[model samples]
Target: MDQLEFAYPWAFILLPLPVLVYWFVPAYRSREDAIKVPFFTEILRALNETPKVAAGLLSPKHWQRGMLILSWMLIVSALAKPSILGEVQTREDFGRDVLMLVDLSGSMDEADFTTADGSTLTRLNAAKNVLKTFIAKRSGDRFGLILFGDAAFIQTPFTADQQVWLSLLEEAQTGMAGQSTHLGDAIGLGIKVFEQNPQPSEQQVMIVLTDGNDTGSFVEPVDAAKIAAARGIKIYTIAMGDPTHVGEQPMDMEVVQRVSQLTQARAFIAIDQAELDKAYQLIDKLEPQQYSSASFRPKITLHYYLIAIVLALHLLIFSWMTLRQMFSRAEVANE
Candidate 1:
């Protein structure tokens, strides 16, 4: 619960004004009206026989005066600006901005990776499952996703919302961008994203996952890594297939290792789902989200209720006075 406070406590000084007015000021004198009615003799008789009730300290009007005084006090209470303040809450300032660069080239569809239960899954699927868990566990850390095939695209911008990041990741389809891998362009894109949201060098990191080497990229992988290193961005490269496989598409572990080394980061080789999971776990341990936060308090006002009560009382008094006047006029017309 928050503590009660007032912004203008000095407004309480006027609370006793109504009471002082009632004590010192004289009551309004009721004038006796003189009117002659030739046809209505009962009018004269009624006027003469009516009791002369003086409105004084013990008059019935004292109740109205008391209500007026109370209404005034409430108005003063509203003016005093009563409020409640919430307790201070601290929020962490994320110290890390990790950009995940995923390869969406056609080769990612390879089902060489198998789960512990002996079920085979595409390389992308295995990576997605493990990365989902990894992203969710990183508290106080901002993450961004970049998908690349023949070209690179920012699937999701830097966000602290894990759900949004995962949603974007899950929506990605293999080779949606193109059939070839543009590894260097993806790294270059990551660097641009980091430059736009510049943070501390120690806090910036990029994780690149690809099964095949660069096929068609405008920038060279090594050159991109050099730029990233100069900008204080650490690059962790993961080669996700067997290096010995001979085909049109092949994993280049040496190039990946060189890129990682150039950026002062380590490289990992994951031939199966298990190794990929282990590599991510090691990365999580090494980075370990770090942050600093500041504390703050919130406030809520309570003077509105008092002001409403005062308005209600004023409306009641006005309505009563209007009815009394209407009845008095009827009596006069009848007489």
Candidate 2:
């Protein structure tokens, strides 16, 4: 809420002018030119009245004087330029840019992760569920999504619209980018996205969620991490599969660890949904989202409203006086 104020309080000085004139100014008086009328005495006798010469000035009725004074006061108030001081407002500013690399390899289709209700879901779906909550909690953070299997591609560019990013994440299916995990190329693409849309004074972060070791990639995962480190991008890794498994679907914990260590970040192993959520929560703690706000009070003039009131008052008085004169004439005519 805001309070009403006056821009020019000095305008109120004019309110006393009519009073001062009444106090000191002489009363208006004018003398008629004396031209002798030969039949003036006869005319006076015909009207059955005797005439006297000396007279005083007649003044307005009390109500008429009051209305004039009120109108003058309103005009002065309008000249004062009444206004209101508006309230303060705030806004959010981003402090971090987080790009997520999710693995879409065939191994991610395994339904081994358990939920709170004792139901099992695929590694990718469990990740998405945890990510939904994670994104919701992270306000004022820019997000980018990269999905990789045999090759790497950007699913969504860096954006502040978390809902749009989540919707795009929902569209990701296992093996859509082909079966083998290409973690290195995904990291490379993440770095490129960060470079392409660089935000000044913002911390860049990369989160890798994968299920298996990289079977082959154009660039090695360690080499990509080194590039990320050189550009000051922190890489957080989460291995979201069974590390004990051997053969084609074996999880490479060392690669995930090395990538995190190279970028001065952390690594986690999430065998179930709970640990997966914990990983994201810890990430949230490490790179917290922050907001900055600005506030101001706007001034809006209200002089026009006061002027309108004055006009309406004058019209009302004019209408009443006109009706009074009309009825008085009608009465005289009837008599």
Candidate 3:
């Protein structure tokens, strides 16, 4: 629990107003004719009291005076608006949701991606390196991962935890799911994952990276792209390794281009790490990081409780005075 604070501390200045009035203002009086009783003088002499009582002060009993002062103090405190202040916390509003659909076909093992330092890495490793950098730069984006080859598998669901996402990404290996490429199945799986979550994302994006044509899939790649397009999901395609070469694991440049075109996104052909980095850089620029932050403290008001206490005190004092007066009247009647 945090410390109590007042909304209007200046209200305390009114606490002494009643005292000031009592000291300076005179009591109200009215004139009346005195009774011409035969024993009035004798009664005053026997009681040893004077009869010159033209004016008198209306003073309350000690208890009544204390209660009145206490009630006034309570009213002032309520007027001040006491409240408890809570600690401040921050919240971040994310801007986008990005899903990466990576291809882990056997062809990805080709050691053809040469970096600027004259070092060679497999296609999957190269893509992973570029992706690590890219994902880090996208600060306010929720990311999900889909690895596909013989079959498609979701490695990580949508999350803002970048470290956990990267950890899952590292666990992926070439041909782990299967050696054959199933681009259409992967796309379908990605769409199904989005449907299952159904969480509202500001912007939805899917980046598809592959090195081979769709060998066998229940749904065709272009048809899957059309479905994704209708669902407002943009698909960016990346064809790894030399696009011109035709071998056992042939690159499907046409399919990649068509998929990107149908979904209103871009396509890239990366033969080296530099080109891969440039592709991610372009996408980063296109979908720039956007977010906002705010801080606030919770407040609990206490004035209502104070008002209730004042009401209870007034009722207590009223009941006590009423009972005392009733007993006093009964005693005089018995006498």
Candidate 4:
């Protein structure tokens, strides 16, 4: 805990001053009292009466005076108004559960890609390189991998185990699943995987990366995207290939655009490796998770301070009472 300000802490110092004055100040009383004794003359002979024989110190009024002084000390302490100020903290976790749908058709084997560094590489190899980095950045997010060719298959289930997912990505090869693109089946499989865990509607996400038009699948790309939207899932489509490359059909832009519009998602065209990297970076920004935080202090103990104050007050009161009793006995003997 921390102190915001001292309202009137200095007033506490006056607590002891009142008690000191009470100890020194004498209580004066003016009253007439007549006591008839059988032998008044003999009593006067046995006892000595003195006006200033420490009678103030020996008076019963000292006890009553001490009580009044203690009351004032309590009042002063109450006026000091000591208080404590503190802080509170809170934290929240928000992340996306993404399913990566990759097209593993024969066209992906075409060697017509150039990295941003101007290095030549196959389309599949360049994609793997950039995808590894993207997977590494999603620390708290659960991810799954799907490879679609003539058929779609789950390479990895939804998990936060990025290392396992990256290893599976490295093993990906052209025509490993088959020689044709099944875009619709890949999305359908993605939906099934997401349904297994049933995450919050807003957190479910799907990203489709393909190098050619869909040629295999019982379902169509547009219909799959519509189903995804109805389930509150967002789909991002990426078309990967060069339009000018010989014997390489340009990516299916029309299908990609239609799917994106139906799902309320964005479509990206990566003609080369540099564009592929930028596409992933754009998705990273667009699907970012929201976060919130708050801070507070740990608990502190204050029992010792309270105990000390009580003990000190008790000692002071006990001392005053004992002194008053001694003074009363002395006054009676002198009379």
Alpha-carbon deviation at 224 in model 1, angstroms: 3.4
Task: Estimate candidate 3's RMSD in Å.
Answer: 6.6
lDDT of each: 0.85, 0.88, 0.88, 0.77
- Which has the greatest TM-score? 3
lDDT of each residue in 16-61, candidate 1, tens digit only: 7766887999777765534545744676477776534445344658
Where in model 3 is the C-alpha error above 4 Å?
Answer: 1-81, 196-199, 244-248, 303-335
Write one digit per residue (lDDT tens) for candidate 4, span 272-312: 88799899999999988543345665344343444456568
Q: For each candidate in turn, give its C-alpha RMSD to the true structure in angstroms.
A: 7.4, 7.8, 6.6, 10.6
lDDT of 1 at 285: 88
- Mind giving the per-residue lDDT tens digits that candidate 3 earns over 19-79? 8998898678887756788898899999999878576567888988888888899999999
1 or 2, greater by lDDT: 2
Instruction: State the lDDT of candidate 2 residue by residue for 1-335, as single tens digits.
Output: 36888889999999999999999998988777345798988988999988767656888999988888888988999999989886665555787888999999888898999988999999999999999999998878889999999988999998889989999999999889998888898999988899899563369999999988888888899999999999999999999867777215667788889999999999999999999999999999988878565677779888898889889998998999999999999999999
Off by over 4 Å in 1: 1-14, 17-64, 85-95, 114-120, 139-142, 158-164, 192-202, 226-232, 244-255, 261-264, 291-297, 304-335
lDDT of 3 at 291: 70
Candidate 4 regions with alpha-carbon error over 4 angstroms: 1-94, 198-201, 243-250, 291-335
Model 4 scores a C-alpha lDDT of 0.77
Model 2: lDDT of residue 18: 92
lDDT value, residue 266 of candidate 3: 93
